[model samples]
Target: MHDFIDHNLLARLSALPLESRQAMIGSVAGKHRSPHRGSSVEFAEYRKYVPGDDTRRLDWKAFARSDRFYIKEFEADTNLRAYFVVDSSGSMNFASGETDTKIQYARRIAASLSYLLVKQGDAAGLSVCNDKIHLEIPPSRSASQLQHIFNSLGELEPKGETGLVEALHTVAEKIKQRALVVILSDLFCDPEELGDALQHLRYRKHDIAIFHLLDRQEIDFAFDRPHRFVDLEDNSTLVAEPNLIVDEYHAALNEYLTKVEAKAHDAQADYQRIVTDQDYEAILSDFLTNRLR
Candidate 1:
C-alpha cells in the first residue's frame, strides 16, 4: 500500500495479536510468558514428580532414561500489558509526501498495535512525548480504551526538540508492572543517552521494542538540487550542495544508525528501522509472528 495506515489494516492485524517476550504482570489470562506453569499449550520446564502430581503430566520418556518420575511442566500464559510511547518531536515531521509525516506513520503503527492488543483481550496504553511526556495513559483492558487511544493520537502534532532519553526514563518509572514497552520514534537523540535509557528499562525488566521511524530521503540524501536545509527542531538553516555532501552525509548517517542498532541489541531490545515508504503491515506481522515464537 502507498500509505502506512488504512482503515482495513486493523482487520488484518486482528488475526495476529501482540504478545510479550517476557513474563507480563497482567490481571487477566491471555497468551504470553507467565510466572507459573499450568495447562498452557507452550512448554516450560520439568520438575520432580510428587505423590499428588497428575499421572498424565508424567514424562514416560524421561522416566525411561533416568528411571525416576518427572513431571512435565508447560509454560503458563497471561494477558500482556503494552504501552505505546510515541515521539512527537519536530524531526518526526520529515516526509517526502504531504500526508506521510514520520509522526503520522508512528501514530498509525501505535494505533494498530493498540487495537490488536485490545482485540486479543489484553491491556494497552499510550504515551505521547517530545522534550517531555505530554500524555500518559495507564494500561487497561477495557473495551473503551481503544477509541480514546486513537483520538489522542489523532489530535497530537509533532513539535519541539527530542527528549527521548529523559522521556524514556520518566515513563519507565511510571510503569510498575512488567510489560511490553513499544517505542515509536525517529530517535534523533544522543546515542549514548539513548542506550542508557534502554538500559534503564531493561533494568526494570520490561520487554522493549523500538520502531525507528525514518523518511527514505533522510537516509538517501536525495535532494535533487542545492537548497537550504532547515533544522526542524532548532530553527537553524544550513546551505549546502547535495552533490558535495551526499557521500559525507551517508557515511555519518550510516555510522550513527549502526551504533543505534548495535546499542539496541546490546541492551537486548528488538529494534526495527522503518522507512516511510515500506509496508508497515508486513513489518508488524513479522514482528508479531516472531514474538509468538
Candidate 2:
C-alpha cells in the first residue's frame, strides 16, 4: 500500500475491471476479445478448412451440406497490456489554492488504475515523460509489479518542458504489440503535433486514452488584481492586470481547448478533460464504468 492508493477506494473499484475498447493480442488466456481464434466458448466465425487444421475444430454438419470442409473458430480471450504515461513537465506541478498538483492528481489516477489492471489479471507498465521519457517499466502481470509502479509514481518530480508528442511517437514505435496507452498530461504542446502522435498510435492499432489534466485556475483565470504570471516550463514572467486582458486570454484558451479536443476526436481516442479540483475516485469510477458500457 502506498500514499497514492486508498484501500477503501480500491475495495469499491475492485468489482469494476479495466477493459479494453478493442481486441488485443496477449500471451495468456484471460478476459477481453482477441484477434486470434482460440478454444473459448464464444463462437466467432467459420473458415475454409485447410491443411494442418485441427480436426477437432471441423464442422462436419456444414461440410455435409455444402460439400466443403469448414473449421469453426471461437473468439479468443486475452488479457490487456496497459502503459501509463504520466507527463512530468513543470506545468504538472501547478495547483490552484489547496488543490493537489497536477502530477499528484495524475499519480493517484495512474497508480489506482494500475492496481485494478494487475489485480484483474492484466499487465501494467509505466513511463514518466518530461523533455524526454525518463523512466520505462515494461508491462508485467506479476503481483509485485504493482509496487514497482507505485514506487515510480511516488518518486516523480515535475520539471522541464513537455515532450509528450515525442514520447507518444516513441511509445507507438516501441510497443510492438497492441496495448492500451493511457496518457495523463496538461498537453501543453501543439494540438496538431499531438494529433499526429495519436494517429501514429492509431495506425499501430493501439487503444489510446488521454486524460487532459488541468487546474481550475488555469481554466478560470480568476485573479482579482494585477498579477505576475510565470511560465512553469520556462523561466519567463509577464506582469499584467487580469481585467484588462481576460477576454483575450479566454479566447486563446478556448481556441486551444477546441483544437485539442477536435484532434482527439479525429484520432478516435478516449479523451477526458479533468479539472484537478474534482474528486479522482469519481473520475476514475466514471471512466471504468463507461468502458463497461
Candidate 3:
C-alpha cells in the first residue's frame, strides 16, 4: 500500500455531487433501471380493476373519451439499498511498503461509497467481518449514521483468519430485502468456498461487486532479498527466495484470480482487481463507468 492520505482522497471524491456520481454509474450499469411506474404519461401494464384499487388509477380521461374504464399503470420508483462488506481478516493488515494497509484502503473505499449512497437518499449499510460478522449496521439514509459508519471503519484493527464464506452466508440470511452487495477483500481463501458464498447472495437477487484488493509488492514479487514470508491468518512462516519462486507464484496467483473472475461473471456480478498502489479515485471512476455501462 502507498502513503496516500484518506482525507485527501475523500476531499477529491466529495467534489462530485452525489447525483452526478450516481448518474455516471447509472450510465454504465445495465442492471439498474428506472423503477418508476404510473399511468400519467409513462406506459405500464394494465391489470383488471379489483376492489379497493385506487380510483385515481382509473383512466377516466380514456373512459370519457372511449366510454370504458381502464386503469392507467406506471412503474414504481424505488430507492436502491446497498450493503458494503469489508473483510477484516488478518491478511488485510499486511503492508509491505510506504502504502497504507489493505484494511485502510478498504475502509476508504467503503466510506466513499457509503457517502455516495447516503447522499443520494439511498439506503446504505456496513458490515465488517473476519471469520464472522464483527459489526453490522442496518441500511439508513442519515448523514450522522454515515459518520458513525466512517468512525467504525476508521477504528477497525484487522486480526484473525478469514471466514469469508461463513460471514457472507450469515449476511445473506440476515438481509431480507434485495440489495447491492459490494465486497472489499484481499480474497486469500479457497476459490470454491468463496464462489459458493457469492452464489448464495446472487440466488437471493442481490447485485454483487467484488473488489479484490492487494499490494503491488504481493502481485509483482518485488522483494529482492531473501526473507521469511509469514501468513498473517495462520501465523505460518516460510523462508523463500523470490527470484526462485516468482514465476511459479505469479502463475498460480493469476490462475486463481482468473477462476474467481470467471465465477463472478457467471453469477452475473462485477469483479474488479484493485491494486492498493494505484490512485483510489481512478479505480473508483473506472468501476462506476463500468457499472453504468
Candidate No. with top TM-score: 2
Question: What is the lDDT for 139 in model 1?
Answer: 83
* Reference-based TM-score of each model: 0.92, 0.93, 0.81
- List runs of model 2 lying over 4 Å from the truth: 49-71
- Better structure of 1 and 2 per lDDT: 2
Two-way TM-score contest, 1 vs 3, winner: 1
What is the per-residue lDDT of model 1 for residues 145-201, given as tens digits with 9 covering 90 to 100?
A: 977888888888888898888988998898888888999999999888999999999
Model 2 C-alpha lDDT per residue in residues 76-183, reported as the tens digit of each score: 999899999999999999998999999999999999999999999999999999999999999999988988899999999899999999999999999999999999
lDDT of 3 by residue, 121-232 (tens): 6777999988788899988877888877887887888988997889889888888766788999998888888888889988876788889999988888887889998989
Question: What clash count goes with each model?
Answer: 1, 0, 19
Instruction: Indicate the worst ten consecutive residues by lDDT in candidate 2.
Output: 1-10
Residue runs of model 1 more than 4 Å from their true location after superposition:
1-5, 50-67
Task: Report model 2's TM-score to 2 decimal places.
Answer: 0.93
Native-to-model Cα distance after best TM-score fit, residue 8 in candidate 2, in Å? 0.7
Q: What stretches of model 3 exceed 4 Å from their correct place?
A: 1-73
Model 3 C-alpha lDDT versus the unseen true structure: 0.77
